[model samples]
Target: MSDNSSKLHQRAVYLRNLLIAHVTGRSVNEADYHKLRHYFMGHKDTSRIIPSVLEKHPDLSDLWQMMKYNYASHEDRKAFIDSEFSPFLAKLSPDSSQPSQALLSQNQFIDEPTLLKHWLKANEMLEMNPPVASEQMKVLLEKLCHQILRELKVVPDPRQHDLTPLVSLTERSLLLSPGKQHYLVVKALVAGCSEAMSAIDNLTAEGISVITDQAAIPKIDKPTSLVLINLYGSLASMLLSGWRVRQMLVEGNSQR
Candidate 1:
């Protein structure tokens, strides 16, 4: 397995063991509530693949709330782990070994500078430096849009800076019209990707605090960045796949 795949597998194993300990054993109190907070802090990337954990216990600070004074949430949290997480973890066992990105074929990412290089750089800094990684994702998406336009023999609009405009331009170039059977679904997916790009834009840049109405927004975390990265890769794959179909159709028509 590739190094990224190995890391993903290790993370899956660790999380499974952690959850099992909580759900199993003699009693609920036997579980270490403090470890829950530690897991979130240390493994921020967990939510990238297994987001349900964060969905259940989003407030990391609240893990500390389960200290000696309070034990009300312990049983409830354990139950969630048993019902939702256990099954997911079971699939991740070394025998099965299915990570989120496992569904994506390796051929989707070519060994080019604009594509794989930036993705690797961004992933390296994903946990340690989320802001930097987020910036890389933006650049990757922008460059990909530019490349797609170039491949179509069209001049990309220099004014189209952000992802949404570039994506709209890409769609226009690809003839993503409303008359198609799956047009609505494709449009919705494209729109969702655009929204993800916008969300990434909102993430803290260069460690700079994002302030709104005198309130500072939380800095971009690993899980959020990873999700955006996954989304970007998926969108890139979709665009390229459509472009390839168009290219073949054009070649066939020209040959006729």
Candidate 2:
């Protein structure tokens, strides 16, 4: 088998074994199984053409090797996935009080930067050398860019003390070597923030009629305002990771 084919086979086997363990309730934890399952569900429609990739980018052997050994044992892998996803899932209400039909029916629109990252990557790969690599690169880049935007939101709104830790976190994540786990954590945060922010912005822009009560409005001072702007630039840096990942994926894909 070609190297790409073999790697794909190994991943497929790993997934299958995980599923079996999950069903047996003996090997994999329930939470980990669900988390890994959700990641796959999120991109179920995408095709993973491993053989074609190997044919295009033969040089990926070393990089793939680096990634292969990094994953922990299957059990540890599951725990990591669960932890990465737990925050996002926790936001959903368990109580049965039904949300308004209007709120439920609104077509969820991902935020501007998130959507832009996806569309831009897709556009760039339209005439690329390898179709599969081009698409994967696009998705990875989109995720990275959206993640940066999410970090922006994490920085204190300037109503608090220094966000040095938050800033450090953003920089640390960005500087890490590319790997599947890193991508997952960053993407989940990005997707969550993108969804939340879009909802907030939409509500705020819904004309003055909908927001008749201005009595309790809070104001931001100059330092806070400047901090917010700087936060935006910091987000821009993270967003650029998508482009970098895109270039790498595309280059690798083309070689196949």
Candidate 3:
């Protein structure tokens, strides 16, 4: 299966199981909770069928509501997850009937161990300590950029603290030729990853926690942090996976 398709199928199964777990009563895992929140709650653009499903199941809807307000501070609590959750996750083979593929993919981090380690750590601290997670995210981005540059035998400037320049350099390093057909998508992915990280950086800086109100204007709260972090994971992992494919093609050509 194509990488993207594999990711989507794996994600669907993962969220489906998470939903089953929620109805069954389980500790609201921070990663799992935020993932579901982004997919089903605030995102109106999600598949219409999903909302219809929720409409039919008030039990699921009520569980989601409790999660929005009182449960944000409690990662050990539970909620619901829908989609866009799987894109950032590591790719899993289709037969891996294990719905825990999300955690399995996370543990594999597969290509980049250090980046994955920091990413997982940041995920764990989202509810308990968002600021620290944000800081770790910055560090994760830096490590990713430096790793990409180093792979191309290019020395990344240690003084560059901002993510844009670093991400741009990594993108260029990943695809040395602007004329390459895949260059545009690679550039877009890198740019998206950088911008999303910037948003996360800003939002997490303001201190995101379990704050909710239907009447009040939305601020950078715990829900937003979870959503954006998951976005960051998707963009970054897709970029890395693409880079891996490029390397494999290069290796195959060399062997011939």
- Would you list the clashing residue pairs of candidate 1? none
CA lDDT, every prediction?
A: 0.49, 0.34, 0.48
Give the TM-score of each candidate: 0.42, 0.22, 0.42
Q: Which pairs clash (backbone N, Cα, C closer than 3 Å) in model 3?
A: 27-77, 28-75, 28-76, 28-77, 28-78, 36-81, 88-234
Q: Give the alpha carbon lDDT tens digit for every residue of 184-252 in model 1.
A: 544554445556556545653465333322222224567877876666666676665556656556676
lDDT of 2 at 160: 21
Clash count, one per candidate: 0, 7, 7
RMSD of 2: 21.0
Who wins the TM-score comparison?
A: 3
The root-mean-square deviation over C-alpha atoms between each candidate and the true structure, in angstroms, is 18.8, 21.0, 16.2
Model 1, residue 45: C-alpha shift (Å): 30
Task: Give the C-alpha lDDT of model 2.
Answer: 0.34
Q: Candidate 1 at residue 63, lDDT?
A: 35
> What TM-score, to 2 decimals, does candidate 1 have?
0.42
Off by over 4 Å in 3: 1-121, 178-191, 197-221
Q: If both were scored by TM-score, which would come out higher, candidate 1 or candidate 3? A: 3
Off by over 4 Å in 2: 1-167, 178-216, 222-227, 242-254
